[model samples]
Structures are given as C-alpha cells and as structure tokens.
Target: MILQALVDYYQRLLERRTEGLAPFGYSPEKISYEILLSADGGVVQVNDIRDNTGKKPQPRLMNVPQPEKRTVGIKSNFLWDKTSYVLGISATSKRADKEHAAFKSLHQEHLAGTQDAGLKALLAFLEAWTPARFAAPHFSEDMLDANLVFRLDGERTYLHERPAAQALRAQLLASQAEGQPPLAICLVTGEPLPAARLHPAIKGVSGAQSSGASIVSFNQESFASYGKSQGDNAPVSERAAFAYTAVLNHLLRRGEHNRQRLQIGDTSIVFWAEAADAQEAERAELLLADLLDDRPTDEQEAARIRSELEKVQKGRPLADIDPRLQEDTRMYVLGLAPNAARIAIRFWEVGTLGLFARRLAEHAADFHLDPRPWKTAPSAYRVVLATAPQYKDSASMDDAASQLVGELVRAVLTGRPYPRSLLANALMRMRSDGHVSGLRVAICKGILARERRLGINSDKEEIPVSLDKASTHPGYRLGRLFAVLEAVQRLALGKQINATIRDRYYGAASATPALVFPVLLRNAQNHLARLRKDKPAAAAGLEMDIREIVGGLADNFPRSLRIEDQGRFAIGYYHQQQSRFRQEDGADSGNTESTEDHIEETQA
Candidate 1:
C-alpha cells in the first residue's frame, strides 16, 4: 500500500509541474561536475558544477537514467559517472582498469551503434580521452571520485539530454523484456510485470550508510522462501520500485530551504499528502511541517501554530481555516530509522488532514498546564529531552529514548495512550536532576491524562493545573509539603544558600516519602522558627499553605508510591512551586532566573 501510494503520487507530481507541484523526475541524480568536451575529443575544461563557497559541495540535480539493480561490476550511468568511466581517467585503484574497460564496452555496444550525431560526437571524444593525458595537469587524483558528465562543444548539450540518449534508454529497458526471469503479479499494482530483483536504495535516514540502505532486502539463504531471492520474495514491480524510491528520495533531499523532513531522535520523519488538487497537497505539506516542528524559529510562527490549533479545537473546517487545504486529503507520515544495512519503519500513520489536525490539537492540550512564568507550552522535542538524564547528550539517545520518541509521535497521531515508559522516564529524570522543569512537569501530566483517557488507570485522581488545597493524595501532599519546606529554607538562609532541600531529598521524597518527609518536617521547624524572627508574616503564610496541603492528607505520608503516583508527586511539587510565585506576584512573570533563585523568590 505504501509503495502504490507513492507511485500514484509520483505520477501526480509529474503531471502538475507548473500549476502546483515542483518539477521532479525519476532516476534523476545530482552531479557535482560537468566535463565540457569538444567534438574532436579535446578537454575544453573541467567545470566544477558545485558551489565552492560552502563547506560542502552544492550539486545540481540532472535528469539521468538509473539502473534498477545494484551492480557489482562497472555499469555506466546514462550520461554521467566517475572520471574513470566517462573519460577513461584511471586512478591508482585497481577498480579503475575494470571501470575503464566497462565504459569502452558499453559505448561500443550502445552509442557506437546509434546514428545520433550528438552521441557519435560524444563517442569520438571518449575514444580519444585517456587517463594519463587527462590527469597530467588539468585534473587531479581526487577529481576521479567526483561524478562527471559529458558536454558536446560550446552548445552545452549533455549526452543524456540528446534525443538519441532517450532512445538508447528505452532500448536498454526493452532488452530486459525478452530474457528476464519468470514474471510475477506485482503486489503494488496487481499487474503482470517482471518483479524487481533488488529494490532501490533509500537515503537520507540519519545514521544510514552514505551509499544508502534498502528497506526490503533478503541476503541470507535461510530467509528466502519458495526459491525466491532478494526483492523477488516480496514481488514489487520495477515500475513500483522506481516510483517509491524516486518519491522518497525527492522528499528526503535536503536543501537550504527544505522543510519536509525532520530528525526526531534516531528517526528521520517525512510527511506528504496525496490530494487531487495540487494546491491542496502543497498546503497540507506546509501544515504538516508546522505541526511536527517542535521548535519553530520565531514567535510569529509559534503564534500562527497556536492560532491554527485554536481553530482545530473549535471544530472549524480545514477549508475555512486555510482555503488551500482540504479536510479529506490523504496524508502520510513515515518515520525511518537506520538498522544496519536496512531501514526500519519506526512508525507509519495514514489519515485525513482533519483527523490529523484534531489529534494534534489533542496532543497540545495534553501539555497544557497552569501558566509557567518561564516558558510557553513546550514543544515535543523539549518534552522528550526532559526525560533524558542530567547532562546527557540527547542527540545520541539510547534505544529507550528512540522508542519513546517513536511511540510519542504515534500517540499524538492516533490518540492512543502514551507509552507507560514515558511516565517512568520523566519521573526518573526528575529524580536524577533533583528538580522538575516546566517541560518535564508538562510531560508527566500529559502522560497521566492520556493514560486516564485510555482507561489504563481511570480510578486515579487527575493531577490539577495548579496546587489543589483540598486533594488528599499522600504523594501529592508530600510533594506540596516538600516545596513549602524548600521555600522556608530559602527564606531563612537567604537566596545565596549553596543547596536547598530539593537538592538533597527530592529523589527519596518522591519515591519513598515515609523515609524522608519525617526528617524533612523536623528540619522545616528550625527554618520556620528562623523565618518567624526575620519575616513573621512570610513565615505565617508559608505555614498556612503547608497546613492546608497536609490537612487534606490527614497529616500522614504514604510509605511508597507507585510509578504513576511518583509522577503525581512531581506534578504536585511543580504546581505548588508555581502557586507560590503566583500568590506573591498575582501574575505570571516571565522570569529567566535559575531554578534556585526562582524557588527562593517564591518565598518572597
């Protein structure tokens, strides 16, 4: 189904060139060098077809025919290849001789037999060009690694662009019609065509091989069944193979202004829509990029997303919000991760644009909490990073982190319960870091809320948007009490104290409250006494807040908390901490102070 959808979209892209879709082609390759040759086979000049100003070469995509199967022997591209094949330029490598021989044989069998004047001219140039002469002064040894294309005279006519080159390509394709292996019904199109022996390589996945990797491959004899080998075992036709690969490569191609692809953890995610209207598809593409991007560049973009999300939540028609978009447009989001020599489909989602938008709004709603002075709602990326251990590099996340990201995306798209491990990881990070970040607290709340929606733990109390004075969950009250104690210490010792109560007891307090809260409460009395001498009114306010939280808990703490309740503990702490700030200022101040300073000011 994925391959067929891609092939259909490929045909659509080909048809809607100027009206809506960008012009693209199958079997096209981006080359970095264009070798301009004269009719008499003289090297006019070796042109660098890449932009040299950047650290990497910026190549141009050219419409050239490609081979269907991976070739172990030298098989020349339609009109472009390495210098060894196009100009017989041999490097010190042993494969250069074989490449030169293969190029000579191919030209003699194909181009030499053709009557096209341009191809004949190109042949004549190839015959006269030699490795030693071409490399002596004009070309370097490193130049042999770059792709080279032939140009006839000053007309700038590439061999592949000539009429005869097209004919030669058709002939080559037709030759496979007679001597090919037994035909099978193509699974993609339900047509009787030669099954592709090897599928094309899929590139642009993070950590995949530079030469690209295969999504469907069978190398071991044990893996083959019914005497089928490689791609034949799956039976995707050549046309379908080309279509899917070309479409994927086009989507994956990264340019300075490209926004269709995003790297999430270890997954490379690409999104596209199949719509009858070309303009609708383009708009859907833009919307998907905006929805998936966790950290958009500017405030204006964030506001735009928020506005769109509001419309989605309000049940506005997609066409009403953006006339270019259609609610019924079929959209696909594929997440690919590198797995050795093959690519793994980490996640695949198919749905209408409206459904996707609504689910995205639900995803945003999960992260919504009482106002945090420090930030707006967190992006998915921020929430995921909050689960990582302190000071750990999130880019090189472990298998667990990768799985969490993949599952999180799946939950957002499908409206499923979030993975249980997400809550566990967030709680772990909270314990490790000794503080709950706004993003972390948001993630915990989101996970538990979804868990309730999915009926995973329907009986559990919901974590509130902010401090709840009437709640009686022991873990929640303990967390609130712990926050009060930290505030009292901050007020008593001044803001310059090296470490607060959180720095010492957050992990134990959240997990085993009975083991730590007694000691904490005892220490809080000394802090309260000191605060009474210095700031009696502040001390009284802090005492009342602590009493209200404990009063709901019946003045008792739980011996231990389950993982879910531990999440509640973190949320309770975060809400109480935020509440203190709100009570003092009566408004959400967008403060940028460190966590310690912020906690200390909550006392003030």
Candidate 2:
C-alpha cells in the first residue's frame, strides 16, 4: 500500500505543477526515492528525480508573464516564494477554535511524518485562508445560506436578485466613484454551499441574463470556492472541485477556450479583454479570479518566482546590440525610460568584483538574444533599458545633464524610476562595506575584484573595505561614507594633496598611511560632487573613470605647510614630496628676484 501510494503520489505530482519538482513532470519510470533512518530515528528521504527524469518539467512561473520585444523598459523576474497555509473552518465557537488548533498540529505532524506534498498544500491553503484582520459579522444560519443574485453589464456588475450581492455591489460602486471602471462583483457566500449545490434560483430576473448560460459545477476545492466544501454542500471527496474549476482557470487564462459571459444568478461576469468575444471573456474572468484566490500572495512565493525568473530571462536585450548605445531603442521597444533607475546587482561568494562583472556581462548579453528578432526593438536600445514599462524619456539624464554626468550622479537619478523601488528593497540587504548595508557596495566590490583577475587596476581604485568608526569621518553622501583616501593614493604617486582642512585642524589624521584607499583627496571631492548632482547618468555612461575624478582632487596641497618629526611622522613620504616641490618653486623665484635687483643696482 505504501509503494502504491508513493507511485500514485508521484504520478499526481507529474500531472500537476507542485512545490518541489519542475513543471515538465518527472518521468515515473526513471524516478527513484529512498528513505534512510537517521541516528535519532528520524527518516531522511531523497529523490533522484531530476537525475532520473533526464529533464525536469519546465513550467513558466506565475504572477509575471514573459516580456515582448516591442515593449520598452527592463522587466524584473523578481518574485517571492509561496507560503503554506492551514485553514480551519467550522461552526460553533469552540469547534472553530479546536479545528484551528488541530490544523496547526496536523501541519506539524505532516512535517514530522515527511509527507512533504500534504504539508506544503496545507500551508498554501492556510496562507490563502488567513486574512490579515477580518471582523466576522454575526449572522443567523439562515442569513448564511440565503442565496444572493447579481447581474453583469458592460464593465459594471449588478446584483439585481440577491440582497446580499446587491448590498455588496452598491457599497463597492459608491466607494469606487462614478467615473472609475465598474467594479466586478465577487460573491463571498456567507456559508459554504451544499453538496450537489444547484444554481441559485432567480425567478424574477430577466434583463440581466447572459446568452448561452450554462450551469458549471465545481467541487469547492477550486480556489474561487476552495473552502466551500466544509459546509454541507460538497460530499464526495473523490470528485474534488479541483477537477472542474482548476481546469477551467487553466484553460481560459492559458487561452484555450473562447467563451465570454459567465452568469451566476443575478451576478454576471463581463469580459474585460481587448479582442476576446463574450464566451471567452467570461472564462477569462473566472480563471483570473481563481488564480488570485488560489495562489499564495506572501513574500515566499514571490521570492520563488523571482528566483526562477532570474534563472530564466525576465528581460533580455538584443544580442547584437551594445547596452550602452541602445538606450532609446530599448526603451521604445520595452516601454522604459532611459534615466529610470533600474539596476541589476550580482554577488559573488568569493567577494570579487571581476566575478560579478563577468557574470553581469554574460547575462546582459544573453538577455539580448531574443528568439523573435523582427518583433522586438532595436538590439542596441533594448539591451540597457530600465525594468519599468511606463518609464518616460523626458526625465532622461542625457537630456538633463547634456554635458557632464558621472557614476554617483546617475545613482541618485530617477524618473518614475523603473524597478528602483524594488531595487531599493534589495539594496536594504546589501552591506555598506561588507557588514551587510546592502548589495550595492557588495556588488561593486565584487566587480573590482573581478577586474583585478583581468589584471586591470585603473589609477584610482578605492573600494571602501570598511568604515572607519574612530577616524575623522568624511561625512555621508548618497547613503555611504566617502573616505578621503584619494589623497593618500596621489601622495604616494608623486602628487601632493591635503586632507580636508577640517581633518588637519582637528589633528585627527591617523598615525599610519591609509594603504587601502587608492585615490587622492581631490578625487574624493570630485566623487562627492558627482554624487551630489541632481540628474546623474548611469555608471556605464559616465565619460571618465571615477578614479580619475578622485585622482584630480588628490593634487590639491597647501604650500606653507612643513613638518619634520622623524620618530613619529604620521604623514607618509608623499607629504615630504609635496613640501620639496613648494621649497623648489620658492627658491627659483627668490633667485630670479635677486638677479633683477643686482641689475637695477648696477644701473644706478
């Protein structure tokens, strides 16, 4: 019986897309499952499903659809994982409370027994059942079973029959305002319908009827009517409502059938499609509603979908096109704004920038390789567009800045910034300087390390390794502390620069050279300026290397400063070089003056 159950379970899993296995369904012939007992007497089960099946099912993710070529902007495959739920419904206060506790305990038992599918299904059911905070209105049993009626007309649906549906629709329409799209009626039955539940009678309804109206029966496990079975109506568990409504939603949304108007008593569901005919439209509504109700909406499923999307191409550019040059075409095709903030950050486990750069470069290229060449925007423009579809070009940095914009300038830039809101969320997890500020520096630092692998160390290379809490801080800019290490770098490279006068006056200079900071003080100042700009451009579009800007700032030096403390000289040899240059220049001027004075005296 256990083997038979496992086999039956495996087959069912293949037929339907479930939590663990891929969509293409595992081949039963090849799948192998084994249970091993742990030292603690707990069982451990592993499935060589993917290996045996040759190719796992490849079901497209939910919530998001694939991007089309003509669409403009960046599309993110961002998703949250689905959460499991355990809904407990019952009559009587004590029974309901007991049922809820039982469900929780049942879930824990499923986890213990290693019945993964049942456990996951229970959790998903529970998640859907859990309303954040709903105040249940006290109702008599008669009120709960009373049938309500409604009608669907154009965009507006009316409950001409059932006072319950009627009352709900009237309240909805009023709250929605007159000019807004008519709200569709969703009949939340006061009680689960009974087994062999016949359609509610509408003896007086006539004008609000749909053509070719047919009674569609569901077993109540359908997402739209999932919890209905707990009531007296649905009995035979073998014929679950999943058989009908699930298929209906799957077929309609997947574009299988072409039916429109779906009439449920006085309530009518009108189609909301651009080209869908009546019959098809009704089916679509039913399917969409089913999806919304059945699918998990919390962070987990979203995370899962997002992870899968990242694995796939949520949005890709035309392969032949360069991302930097294809901004306009990409936006036009993708419907994204050029300056809208859409950033893709990748982290490397080894803490190297080169790995990130290499991977990003690869994925960015792969994104452009759309199979439908003629259907998309130009390859160049589509490659580097933002992830927002409604992004406008008027707020573009190129148009605003016109001449000068750099990395920091662009980072702060926005214009209905596409997906930046999402990016900001991701950025929260990023570490500022390896301590988990977020992904920004983590990604940048990784890129730097990747570049190092390629033997490319540009002149100015200061990836803030850590925040100096005790040192004289250089103030925060663009949410990060900008260290004035550019001064240290230039001083070492035969250039002279001083720390900000504030640092000098306070005598807060560290007693050692800042070995990690690779830029000069002047360059650091330039970075600060760039970050302060209102309309910054993308980092990829910056005309000059960020290091050079910092390097320039490192050149500034005060000519009147001289110090000789051999034993405890906190300043490096670079300080001595700057002093030497000032002395040399002073001596040359003095000599020239002396010669002129002698000549004048002689003439006298």
Best by TM-score: 1
User: Distance from true position, residue 393, model 2, in Å?
Assistant: 33
Residue-level lDDT tens digits of model 1 in 1-604: 7777778877787776522222322365667787676666677777777777788776666666673344576676666776666666655546776777777777777776777766777777767766657654557765766677777766766877777787777787777655678888999999999888777787788889878898888989987999878877898887787778877877787764667788878778888888878677879988877777746678897788766766775677887778878888889888888999899888899999889988988877776666642333444555565576644223224533766777788889999987778788878877876757676777788888777777888546776766677777776777788888888998999967998889888999999988998898898899899889999999999999877877788545788898878878887887788777767766644443335433422321
lDDT of 2 by residue, 1-604 (tens): 2112222333353364533222210110111211122223222221121233327432232211111111233211101111111122223333443434444554344334332332333344334444232123311232211111112222122212223433433443244244433232212222222232322111111131211111232424552354453322323111122222222222223212322222221122222221123333233333323211112256675455334223323333322222222211100000101111111111002211122223333332222211111111111112111111212221122222111112211211111112223222212222111111111222223233333334454423332333212222121111121222432233333324443422332122211123212233445455445443532442222223334323333243222211111101111112222223334457432222222212322221
Model 1 ranges off by over 4 Å: 18-26, 52-56, 67-72, 90-92, 135-142, 313-320, 373-376, 392-400, 589-604
Per-model TM-score on C-alpha atoms: 0.92, 0.18
How many angstroms is residue 516 displaced in model 1 relative to the true structure, after the best TM-score fit?
1.0
Model 1 clash number:
0
| Count of clashing pairs, candidate 2 | 96
lDDT of each: 0.74, 0.25
- Model 1, residue 230: what's the lDDT? 83
Clashing pairs in 1: none
Consecutive 10-residue window with the lowest summed lDDT within model 1: 17-26
